[model samples]
Target: MSVIAILVLDGLPGHHLTTPGLVFGTAAREHPGVAYEVRLCAGPGPLGIGLPAPLPIAVPHGLEDLADADVVLVPGHDGPRAQPPPGVVDALRGAAARGARIGAVGTGVFTLAATGLLDGRRATTGWRHTEELARLHPRIEVDPAGSVVTDGPFLTSAGIFGGMDVCLRLLAQDHGERTAGETSRELLTPLLRHADRVQEDIDRERAGSAGIEPTLRWLKARLHLPLTPADIAAHAGISVSSLNRRFRARAGVSPPRYLLRLRLDRARELLLDTDEPVERVAALSGFTSAASLRRHFSRQTGTTPRAYRARHRPATSPAG
Candidate 1:
């Protein structure tokens, strides 16, 4: 189970607070193996909202929760320029030091920038505030147009819906694209957006220019066979560590995770595009047996292959 702690500052937007909860909560509810304990934490007092005549609300936890969280989310507050309270900065810096994946949504990026962890890292805030973020924190590279920018453990999203995008990407990393897609469908949302297209373009440029594009293509062509990291390294004509480094630099995910997504994608294609039975699909997609395919497929997609095919593929052909 992953522990997600949302750090709420006084005057934080209510919508921002609930968005992550909705996303991660939905993922956990729909996927069997994915679990998350989400909590809201404020420092030393009742929570305060930015709304006119907002009432004080008590949060269930405090700064201590941030220390042990697997992921800590910071949401936009009402005042973009207001310096984060001393305790907030300290807790954020401490969380970053402890290697908790930290995310700042919208103008919340300002609060994160105040902690200096985002210094020298690629980040972005809401488009409207990007200029101020750049002007205020010259050390941080702010992309005014980026809907989401991830630099290692730190993630920043430009707008409110961008928060949803961040959550889906995190879900993909945790489970897989199929799970993320199902979660998105459950929410009546589309998983891919302009930011993802932009990211794909960036990934493509990086991979192609780095000369590993052919290696990736080759791996895709051969995903139905048993392959190892060492095999991939040899195919790329590089050491394992070098291959990992290049993949990390260009793709933002490890080679194995990338390949797994590829295999699952192929399986999905086969399930939807052909009438092959589950056993054949399993064999063709590199799973050792129908049970292996069923387990992984159900885990990643929240549906059996038969069900997925029934839903996505036509039940009958046109009469000739």
Candidate 2:
């Protein structure tokens, strides 16, 4: 069995941080039984400091679990926020030194990057944290804007809603695509060969509500067509003011701002997928012009539209 370890710490976004194991653990239980063993290591051993909560995982292992692991996974965390537990950094470094295949979700990349393991390598984290990740590790070539990026043995994802994608990628590699596709179906989440889920969400944000979810889904389905808050409120069967409050509460963003992200998402796909001129991609994605598209894309992604396309484009093409 290939041992996999997940570090659990204080204030971690429990859901995003834990998805990989649960999802991949499901794969382990399937018919034909793959030899993947998952464990949560508790430590500051062979290193520094002590472990944090959910004490003594019943895995019949300790920090020593990593010493024998084939792969190590770090899930997204909220804290010890930006910095990793000193113990985690040391352990990760040790694991890599021993040749463990490592992966992370969301800001977990920060922890991995801190080990100096990700230097000069491509990695990712939550879309919201892309800039911060890049700033902290410029040599890393951070792709927080994308769902999943593999830099040799270091695998990472724009975590949050992205751990599943990263795990599935690993699954595809360890098992085959049919196994991965089946796992994806069992997971009932979108399949992202590289960066699908996050990118799809970006694609979706355009047709979404300037208000809240589910209701926004209806609106996102119509981005190429013109619509407004009033139209949205009417469609969702709520007064404009009520809709605004609901959106803020549920999505923590205004309806229009959310819609803007969606439009930008679509614009990015066009930039990469089509030979469309920037101006044309702009128009197609509902931006006023190429200039408008570049401004927003750069602001959101920390790289210019063309630069982003060039860097992230499939291996087929040359420089953009």
Candidate 2's displacement at residue 254, Å, is 26
Clash pairs detected, candidate 2 = 125-158, 205-262, 206-262, 207-219, 207-220, 208-220, 209-216, 210-255, 211-255
TM-score of each: 0.59, 0.55
Please report, in order, the local distance difference test score of every candidate based on alpha carbons: 0.78, 0.68
lDDT of 2 by residue, 1-320 (tens): 76777665444565644576677777877737666767777554332222244332233456666788777887765552466765777788888888877888876778788888888777677767877888878898765345566655678887556677777777765765567777777777443444676756754674353435557787667766566889888888889898878776555456776677788878877766777677777777777777877777764544576765665554425433
Please write out the lDDT profile of model 1 over residues 185-250, one tens digit for every residue: 888534456658877898778977666888899988997788889998998999999998887666
Q: At residue 224, give the lDDT of candidate 2.
A: 64
